[model samples]
Target: MRNHNTLKWMIGGLVCGLVMMACSLSGLAPADTGDSEVDLQKTQLALQATQLSIQADQLAATQTAMAVPAAPAEPAAPPTSAPAEVPTADETKRVNNVNGVYFEYPAWLASDVAASIYDAPPPNADDPYFLIEVDHRVFEFQNYSLADHFLTPLINVYPLEEYQRVNPGAAAQITLLKDLISWQSLGASRPDGLPFLPIFNAAQSFFTKVEFINTDSVNGLRYLTQFQQATYPIQNGQMIYTFQGITTDGKYYISAVFPESHAILEPYDDFEYTAEFEENFLGYLMEIGEQLRAEPDESFNPGLDALDGVIESLRVE
Candidate 1:
């Protein structure tokens, strides 16, 4: 009888387990427990535990993704050529007692100045005895030019009226230049034989890169070209950059000439004075001018920009 009762109990437990599994698989509510409130609390706790487990897995996935490093970026290409260097004026020089003129030049160059009077006779001198105070500044590179003795860069400042009074031939040109400055009309071409004061005999030819510039208290025109009287070939160091300026009050004249060279030109000694060159020198000069006009400012030795910088920093009180 005891064994029979045990079998009956086992059979009842198996039926209960089968019924519970069937209810869970079919998405049906479990058969109600006698203690209704306790059964509801148990279901709530189980749901919360499952949600907490899912949230923990998601947080771990996010952290794992963040910890991994990203792929490195591709490097940029190298430049084809090094950039040209821009020069700076590191030294300031002054000409005292003559309109309080002062200018700055590149520190890399050697420079000096002299103040004197031009008592010599001018071809157009109104008064041969009339003296004009002149201040001359010279700048030179160590070993750049064979013609350094005459081709060194120079700056001269003097009274414009005195210069015009002495060289009366330049009076009209001075007036025209002043008018150009005042009106700011620079489109028209300037004629040849332009005077560079304190420098007689030579004339400026084939002006290129012509532009008007202003110093501290004056305005002037600047251009690049060679100066000559005869049909001379454009030699390397003979090419010059010059600035001619007048004070706003038209009292002082500032003149700057800087010798320059380019790879396109030949050295003075190397050039052949062939008869063919002389016959067509005009065309040759014009062609050279066109080439120089097209070249970048940085292409010239002691670049045009560096020379312009000195003029821009000039101050005449």
Candidate 2:
């Protein structure tokens, strides 16, 4: 009903405008005309046309509004990259106590492996030679057949004076071992056997990754090398990583030898020691040492870092 009234008002306004236009076209004043009914009909038709045009415009406006889409939401920020995690020491450690001395080894080394402790005989029976062994299973060697089963992997502790006292005949060897103040002063000649220990055979070789490591009570040198009596190529199950250190008080000596293998090395020690090889044996050993030194600690089985952790936890008292 309100819309009908609004439409009537609009028709009346159009009719007044048409009347004025007609008077102007006819050159007369806007007064009552003889064709008033005809003018009224023409005004109503014009009003309907104007209303249709308005309705079309409103319909077009509504369709345009529906066609357009809302603006896209802002993109989320890129995720931040996290820093590389630093390796931590294993929480599970086995406290190894032997001959009143104590240290820790990884619990993994003791699991599923034969371990024993014995008083190894020194050159002088009076000297103390405490030894502990962990069987070969502890090391995952590719060529276990080539390993020295008798040696296994062992840690030994000895009284410095008694150890030095036993080999009285070899005064030069004893003096050299005693004078081992630094690895930098190490001569071209490597020790044939374990430092100050008896040797059935000795290997002439160079050291790799040589570093001085001190435990809670001792200070010593740790290095990786193979013990070969002949010109044997560096192979799996033959490389020995050993640590030799003296107590801070200089009263006791400590040594730990662990068998390690590398995937980069030959699976077997099958190199022929020909005359040419003998001539360049030192060069061969140096090249091999360089290759081993270039590799990161993780390259070896049971990792050198893990062994260093064991040495760091030692307490001779």
Candidate 3:
């Protein structure tokens, strides 16, 4: 009986030991799996947290870049100026004076036929003309014969005849003479006996040229003309001439003289001798007037009287 009891005790002890060992093993296995799962979850959570932190850092960097200010643009440059123009010397010295005039005479007196009537021929081949000088501002006659013959007759007879063919009247003659004298006075003062004529009755056509120049303290007006188809009646003929000149102080002076005669009017009964003689005498007067006006002797009475003493003293010897 003692042996059986001891054996039973030993068996019981072994059974208890095995049961404890089995329970412990089972518990250990489950615990190990749970621990592994928990560790994996922890690792994933850590990784996600790290990625969120990186994203926040990137956002902060972008905000900083956007807040920065942009630089300002530069201003435009200014424009340049052009150079000024200068005037020439000649342009500064230009003159302002200007004047003009015309002279007319019978065409017959300008031709050779008129020359035969005169004992002494005139100085210039072109007689019955006028002269012009810019310095003196004067126009003087060139032929005394032509002026006297035609000019005097027209003056004396035109008034008596009333400009008609038969009896020339004094009023008509004076009127014509005055008109002629006015034209002559355009450049200079006319002679005492010379009538002033402004209208060009004998001239068929006229031309003129003008130039401007400055004189000391005075403006000069220069005028020049070329006559065409001029006509006048002479002894048994018609007279024609060309004329030109400058005017100063409202007077016309002669520049050049020319005269020619052609048969136009027939001789009238006994009027021939008287007409011829009168024409010749008047022609001489015109010639003398021109000569006196041109270069009169300083010692002469009226000619010298018109000039200043100094100028008269300087006259050509």
Q: Which stretches of candidate 2 lie over 4 Å from their true place?
A: 1-89, 96-98, 112-150, 169-178, 182-200, 269-276
The ten-residue window of minimal lDDT in model 3 covers: 40-49
lDDT agreement with native, every candidate: 0.51, 0.48, 0.23
Q: For residues 205-264, write the lDDT of model 2, one tens digit per residue.
A: 445776677555877777776543345466665577788777788876666667677767
**TM-score to true structure, per model:** 0.59, 0.55, 0.16
User: CA lDDT of 169 in candidate 2?
Assistant: 21
Candidate 1 residue lDDT tens string, 133-220: 2332232233322234234355656667766765433454566567667766442332332324333223343556666787557798
Evaluate model 2: give its lDDT: 0.48
Best by lDDT: 1
Clash statistics: count for each candidate: 0, 0, 80
Badly placed stretches (over 4 Å) of model 1 are 1-99, 111-149, 183-185, 188-190, 193-195
Model 3 lDDT per residue over 68-142, tens place? 575686786575766554433222111112122112332222221111011222324432111100121222222
- Model 3: lDDT equals 0.23
Model 2, position 193: C-alpha lDDT score: 27
